[model samples]
Target: MAAAATVVGLGGGAEKQHAECLPTSCSKHHSPKIRFPFRLRGHHPKNCGYPGFDLSCTPHSEYPVLELPFSVNVLVKNIDYTSQTIYISDPHGCFPRQLPNLNLSASPFQLLSNYDYYSDLSFINCSQTQDQIWIYRYRYQIACLSDESHQVYAIDSMSLPDISCTKMYNMSLPSEIFGYSYGPITFDHLRLNWSKPECGKCEARGKNCRFKNNNSSSTSKSQLLFNGSTECFDKPSMGAVLGPTFLLVVVIAIYHVYRSNKMKKADQVKIDKFLEDYKALKPARYSYADIKKITNQFQDKVGQGGYGIVYKGKLSNDVHVAVKILNNVKGNGDEFINEVQTMGRIHHINVVRLVGYCADGFRRALLYEFLLNNSLEKFISTDKEKNSLGWEKLHDIALGIAKGIEYLHLGCDQRILHFDIKPHNVLLDNKFTPKISDFGLAKLCSKEQSAVSMTTARGTVGYIAPEVFSRNFGNVSYKSDVYSFGMLLLDMVGGRQNTVAQNTSECYFPEWIYKRLDQGEDLGIQIEVDGDAKIIRKLTIVGLWCIQWYPVDRPSMKVVVQMLEGDGDTLTVPHSPFASTNPMPTRGTTGGRTFNSELEVISESE
Candidate 1:
């Protein structure tokens, strides 16, 4: 399995420092090599490893302590980078002492449980007379139990002595220490496995792996080095070396050229085959000439955004459509097809419908149902448009957006997380019904999984949840969309962009709204009637609830829909989201407050 490349959040200087460190290093006392996904605390910077793999080295101790998930620390005995497994030992040398409290429920590591490699030891308590009699019944001595208890304990449950004992219990442990005991206590070495940062393949390819920063960007990618040589000694016949002979060199050079061309064509063929399969699966595929005919040679431009430009077009049936011609696509038309397959499978009143797509050669475009009202951005820009919407219409739009998001999360066979959920992505139809659009950054995972691993940050800066940027806030999950939805809700209420800098003393809208709510003030905004005021209050309270600092604190979209539909007066205000006058939490630090229970404390660099 290829390990996922994690784009960690770190400063340029710190990231560069870790990148410059040796690819593989060893502890001063031990020879176990440590590399990416397992960095030594003082030797390598925190960004060198995945979250929760920080290794702390002590001057006197022979083994380094690995900080596992849930903050449990264990001594590392050896690590097999090929198998992605680690042999660990208890620091106290008595594993049974801590077995009662052993918990890896939420950690990324799992204890080895293969029955062929482990056996069970049953701990039992019995009277002196019972112990003496059982020692005779079973040829194996039961005296290898706890010395303090002086009770006969069965080493293996399958071969019990057939004698009765009180309070008998068993635990499965690694069989490596089956015959080894230290004065009636067994050894405590165990094995654990992790599937992050699959570097074994890189090593097998005769390359070194490390986290490399491109320019001075805040994100980093896992890079492999070939060193201008192919030393694949593991494979037969390929291990033979080439000597300096004119004829032999020519043959080898030709082979290398053939191999390079073969690999490049292989990659292109894979992408082509994938696109071909998608075309066969869906009827939405359109030819380039057909797109030109439908779009009338790109005549009328309707709207434009960062992803692409939208043009008004008419299909053969006389139905109007909006065609988006992608601009500056980064990779192999994956994003284009992603949008096609994602929108094609979805069917909801509040979700935009995909009519067809054009993936002919290099030209790519997506055809969607045309909406007369443009986007929610235009309606919320001025007071005239705001009055036209009224509080009732705006409330309905809010609820509609929530329902669309809920559908994306729960209604689909696979849970789709729309990373970007700003106002611009929400379009309004002729009836003012809002539908979610622009799924270029969306991710799909099994409905059973609460979180998905992301290689890079996907959403806009202002609306992105803290966890998306840093794992310290929490794991990136569906709750991230709720945070963006919260920001959009606040933007709708204030009739201005939440990220914009204000000229007045107030820096952000959330802080100002929180202050008003805290003081039991009437919001002091212009309102036509008591009904409008009540609706505004409900939206504000729900917005605050959605923007809670921690993902766990934010309500899910399902709950958000319920809150918007429920009575305003009965709703309870959430805890202070903008707790301090500062509108946002400090980016680089943990804020000096203990949220250990709320989030996993992986590393200080996050």
Candidate 2:
């Protein structure tokens, strides 16, 4: 007994860990963490912590912070050392930012709320059984509870919601529970409903039985027997067969779990290969049937447009996705590519993420995270509009749009020119956060040059700057986008579309804005005396500066961001925008690179 005890102790004995982590910064300000006095030889080596990880501290906040660069923030509110989860204040402003990016590659997160996990459903015609199912599944989705790890529930001190983005009184989660396991649930909890039972194929000699028929009054003695096997159906005693049937059910459930895991592994492998090759774009590819299942046969149309109708759908148990199937009449091939290429590489908080795409033969589609609120155009340009957004929201929208465009211009290796920048293209999120989308007319410029090759003029008539339509103005540069952005800004300030044209040859409203600025007058757009007038005036001035016919007169997106952010006192009144009629000087070349310009004419993007 003593020898056995010694062996067990040795088997489970604690082994020393081989890491020594350091603090982010030294307490003394001028003195670095490892300076002249600190030893680098005796106890100091660079590789002290985990491999592929580094420590850094920033002076931006009040106290020094120790952080892992690519890993999740370790400033946990409460931690479960055993489960390795920390209840943190809403870090991502959604839910707890899972550490090591969560390897629930194994056990799926369980819900406590009823069926309401994602976009709430009105359930115009839902099944009666669903009412109680959700109650067992999820706890109430507290609005914006970012620290919702199982560990957080273990502790009760999750921080309350932050209402700075949009005021909300209570908790509200954004997805729904689409299905359930009537029997046993799997580990990952994602079993595609792809299996079927073959009761019709049951053989009589193999002891098969039908769902007890209640129609016929006359029954065979062998069929109705309390215990028998030899009969017309070779049916065994009902009691004896039930145990086998229950066992079969369990076996079937196990088989389904295996099949589901196999399918998931296959799908994940494809996604991994896709990420490896097409690292920038993450487009969801749903089978046609999956799309149909998601949208419930296109029964619920959220928004209709010239190109297509947007149907809201949930892809997974918790993933809310928007499926945009190209309308039969409006688009076809390259137009789909236009959006995919333009949105693929771009990722920003202010921009809508293109999750995935699909282009099976005869089908063209694009998938994106569903933005709760629609376009900014709808709110501002509605009949009897309220204009309750006030000035702050408008200012925020302008800044967000500018930042998005700036990302397209400078964040990517190749410069992206949003040829169509307007109120209609700016969408609002759940919190009225702005996202830029719709890139059918977008163009790409080489990293080194300001000019992009174009054979034919593109973009909406009103939003297109003068230089893009005319060559004499100057080399069409990144400033063209600046011009378009400025026009959008002016529209936001105008709070209406610049729809009126004196003739086919003129852009009436921006010209009107410039004239008013020249005479030191405010834009005549019907805006009430709200506090946002200051931001409106700034946008108007900046927009006017942006639409200057010569590219040189337009401000870069960087400066545009600064002007939007800075106080009104720092602003300079804009000069009159170059009119289409203005005689422009000769323009420069495209720096010698030549490529034929093409327009993406189809709307199918996935």
Candidate 3:
């Protein structure tokens, strides 16, 4: 910008300050780390504190208290300067009144859908029905864009009119709530400063004073240009001939850029040396040209998913592959590094292998040894024409997927729970061998730990068990993945997308399966006796046992494998499974209507 300035708004009105909000060396407890909107009280009579920030030390409490302008009574606890969030205990069970009342219309901070930064806090009203509602205030996380250095600032969520509080408050805290005030807000523009020799006549003189240039001038850094003219009466074109001088400046600027880039590359080389541990995965560095070549110049589009385009490609020597180049703005973390760090160490015959990856200055890519088949869902759902997967193939696919998930839970040194475990993530190799892919959303836990705390739920809807969705059942553990696997089995048996009928319609899958088994409806699913269909049916039953709503009821994959490979003749029917809030009708005495059309289709297609 040609000209910029900082405007400070006081509670009464606006004012200006040259120096930033840094504290001066006026006191022993003075903090220089404070910036903007935060001012040293009593340091300057001009009300130095920045707007929207109210900092105070009261004689009533042992520590200093910081208050938001809107929540006069609410005291902020534990400010993580790095993470840019503040923790505050809730004053009540429910807040009819919003502190800052986060106006989506106002702040730089925005609420995310299916996600939130300020999770509610719950204080039980045990006396009356034990009505437990989440308390209104908790820690508000500020997610700043690091590349642009986004930071969580207090004012980012506060409203301008709502930012009015008493400047002082008495803290009967951890007890009585108190009121506080917000200072003024003045930091809207950039302030430019230059030294002017005071007694500053030198600046006032037309011969030297550069305050000489008006603010309307296009450029601020004006200078005097000496002309070769012998007469002062000549047109004032002396400044225009400074072209050669400016040419010299341009040459110097180019030389500086070249040197700086060279130094940056050298620094990057040292950084690469420090990252040697990542070398074993042998992540490939692909040029944009290589990316084009591998994907046949992206001639064939694999499919479009949440992350980005999935393209089928090959390495230099014709090694077929699938490449998922993350979108420039993909929210999922770097898939290349995420996959490499998670799946790199573990090698299972049933799990997909990582061929290589690419991470350069501008371009980030991952290269995987491609699979022959797209995914199990494609063959299963494309239509009767593509229903080539019979009971045997489906059974084999189910068992293979189970083993892969089982390996993730038990085979590796760390027990990993593949959060997103559905047919979409399961790929088949050339010989119909199922290889589990996409460990990017996987979570790691230990043997002793039965559950890991998850702040937010991850994984696709419907496939996730009720226990995993809400903690009413219990904590999250590897069993969460087991629950998801159970849903997959139900889908395999039904031969249609599981989520659609369950979530949007009256069809509850597990309950439907449980009802048929109870009445002994031949499992209604036709797998041959002592053959692939029988094996798959047994696996389906075992899957029902695994996703029994309660974590304890679900069997581990180790037991599941045994059940799948177990003899079909002696297999016993498991009890009825748990039903969701909107329970589905049981099919104990008769067949389910939803499965009627799909069942005949699966049988005929097979």
The candidate maximizing TM-score is 2
Query: Which segments of model 1 are wrong by more than 4 Å?
Result: 1-283, 316-318, 330-339, 497-504, 579-606
RMSD per candidate (Å) reads 21.9, 20.1, 25.8
lDDT values for all models:
0.65, 0.50, 0.49
User: Stretches of candidate 2 above 4 Å error?
Assistant: 1-95, 98-281, 304-307, 316-319, 327-342, 382-386, 497-507, 522-531, 580-606
TM-score computed on alpha carbons, candidate 2: 0.52
Q: What is the lDDT of residue 44 in candidate 3?
A: 23
**1-606 per-residue lDDT for model 2 (tens digits):** 000000000110011111111111222343223211111212223333221112222222211122221123322222222232223222344333233222221121222333434332221112233333332333232233323321111111133232122222222222322233222111121111101112223332343322233123565432322112221124334455445444544564576467556766677565444333332323434457767887779877777666677788766544566778875723555666565766766767777788666665567777777887888887667424526676677788889999999988788656777788888888888888999877656776665644566778878777787767886676666777887888787767665646545446555677766766677775555566665567777777778767767776666787788778877655666445555545452222112211112212212112
If scored against the real structure, what TM-score would every candidate get?
0.49, 0.52, 0.47
The per-residue C-alpha lDDT of model 3 at residue 533 equals 56
Q: What is the lDDT of candidate 1?
A: 0.65
For 566-603, candidate 1 gives per-residue lDDT tens digits of 88766666657754643444221112322223422121
Q: In lDDT terms, how accurate is model 3? A: 0.49
Show pairs that collide, candidate 1.
3-198
- Against the true structure, whose lDDT is highest? 1
Q: Candidate 2: how many backbone clashes?
A: 36
